[model samples]
Target: MATASVVVPAREEAARLERTLASLGRQSFDGRLEVIVVASGAATLRIAREHGVVDRVLTDDRRDGPGAARNRGAAVATGDVLLFTDADTIVPSTWVRRHWRHYATPAVVGVGGPLRPLADGLSHRVRFRLLSDWWYRISWSVGFVQQPGPNCSVRRSAFEAVDGFDESLPFLEDTDLSLRLREAGRVAYDPDCPVRTSVRRHEREGYLPLLLAYLVGYLEYALPGRSPTREHFS
Candidate 1:
């Protein structure tokens, strides 16, 4: 088993972070795993340690967006593979193992799994269908893109080559980074491996605008090569 670090980005997420940790503790890999929580204000150290996280709890006082925090976590991590996820997500038992398995081949620079909404709704269904169509296509599509961060991983070397996650463009940084990665190396999707994700967006804002907003954001970047704004994350 290779050394893997689970980098979870959280912001005032103490309540849900435990579920992520519990999910991580159950991974099937059985290797030396370290849980790196890149957070600020959300003191997850006690909960992470309580859940038996292998490495020291990490944080960024600057409170930069999740991208910045993830970069911070990656800098301190001592793993060959870097897995990026959200603190609100729940990883399946085989989450780490399945992700690590793909790296057996060198060309596989990026690997992503299913991002299933924890709760179902009309919004989730509509968006999920569109997303699935995008990711399953033999080739990448302009309007359709998949960079499901919660279940995505890449080799530490490749990540370093690309300079980890982009600190600019606070929102949709994964999309920005994945675009560069897909160009440099291959991005893989695991049909069998999926991770549980929160439906907070639906819970807060209804689905239609989000779908449209995402399209607008993607188009904004695609046509002009301009990164999205910080407020986009909100």
Candidate 2:
């Protein structure tokens, strides 16, 4: 009977937000599911309010980035579990339920799942499978946990203990949060709770270049005596 909250941070993504909201409405989780939309743009806020399934629509005119917006959403969330996903991602019907199930193990403080490509293209599919799905599985097996923003959930108490996602980090904020959550308890990777996300960034910026940029950013954050700067990715 645990309540859950899904926080979606969006900025000028009306079309994609529509699809994301629609998918969330079909969630199989029977508990008290609260959907909060932390939107920055006018169109995004409008779309979120118009959605029949959205329980709350919080505006973020500052547009401080997804990390800040997600923090805002989590601040007001009234659920035992706080689920985070992007406006461009489409989760499955059992997404919420699967994420909640992981919390049955008291040691599990956070849960992350695989990502699939929403766009249709062989290149997108192959790249996602290798870079995303395969990488998450392998890295997790070695104790390097990564919880992508598009499909990750955390215990409310554990999130508050870590002070939630670092608002200053422009990229890899979720990974930073995951690493911190590991200190509190187990951060699990659930392969069955996959979500399909948009590949627009890769399509626009070219996959290889973006991948290299992420690697550099991750290294900066992961290496000792180094910290991540406010380098905007999107």
Candidate 3:
């Protein structure tokens, strides 16, 4: 069986990490898979231990962002495939299984797509879920897709070739890495394999502010001549 290493980067997300670990323990992937939780604080070790995942946790100081943390985890990972996910997400029972299938395809280097957000409000929940779900359906039907980073996997070699993520980015480092990942190989979406994540981060940033930050991020990246400052707006 092909070995797979799942890297989950977390900060002070005790409230959500517990459930994330729980879901991981139940993944239905048909290969040897182990999780590496990149925790960037003292509390992270406690949470990982409490959740009985310290056997695979790596505690680091908060100096490095998720990109650095992920690299720290990857350095010790012993797998052919490197999967990444957020500390505040829930994997489907068959999430890993589906990803493994995709990774088995020699032509595929990375697998990922949208994350269906579960909101507290019923109306918002319905709207976001529908939109997220519909996007998956549409993207797959069109044979063009983009990953959400939190739900992505890359060939270990490809990741190393890109020198991992650009640790310089504070936020949207995932987006930066995704761009490089696309250049390395084919990236696609799995409509049936969906992961649900908390919108707390988005909630923390608020709708208008988050939307503006997203727009600024796009503009900053698109400008090419100038660069954007670290986005702490969220």
Task: Order the numbered candidates by TM-score, best leading.
Answer: 2, 1, 3
Top candidate (lDDT): 2
- As a whole number from 0 to 100, the lDDT of residue 96 in candidate 1 is 91
* Candidate 3 structure quality by residue, lDDT tens digits, 1-234: 688888898987777888889988887777788888888656766888777543488777765787898888889999898888888888887877787777667777777756777556775566555555675457445543445657888789888988887787776676566666766777667766778888876678765687678668756755645433223111
TM-score of each prediction: 0.87, 0.95, 0.85
lDDT of each: 0.75, 0.90, 0.74
In model 3, the runs with Cα more than 4 Å from the true position are: 126-146, 226-234
**In model 2, which runs have C-alpha deviations exceeding 4 angstroms?**
228-234
lDDT of 1: 0.75
Per residue, candidate 1 scores C-alpha lDDT tens digits across 32-135 of 88778876553565566556654666656788788898898889988898898898899899999999988888888888776777777766765665564344
Residue pairs in collision within model 1:
none
lDDT of 2 by residue, 19-117 (tens): 999999999997999999999778888999999999999998888899999999999999999999999999999999999999999999999999999
Give residue 51's error in model 1 in angstroms.
3.0
Off by over 4 Å in 1: 42-45, 120-145, 228-234
Model 3: number of backbone collisions: 0
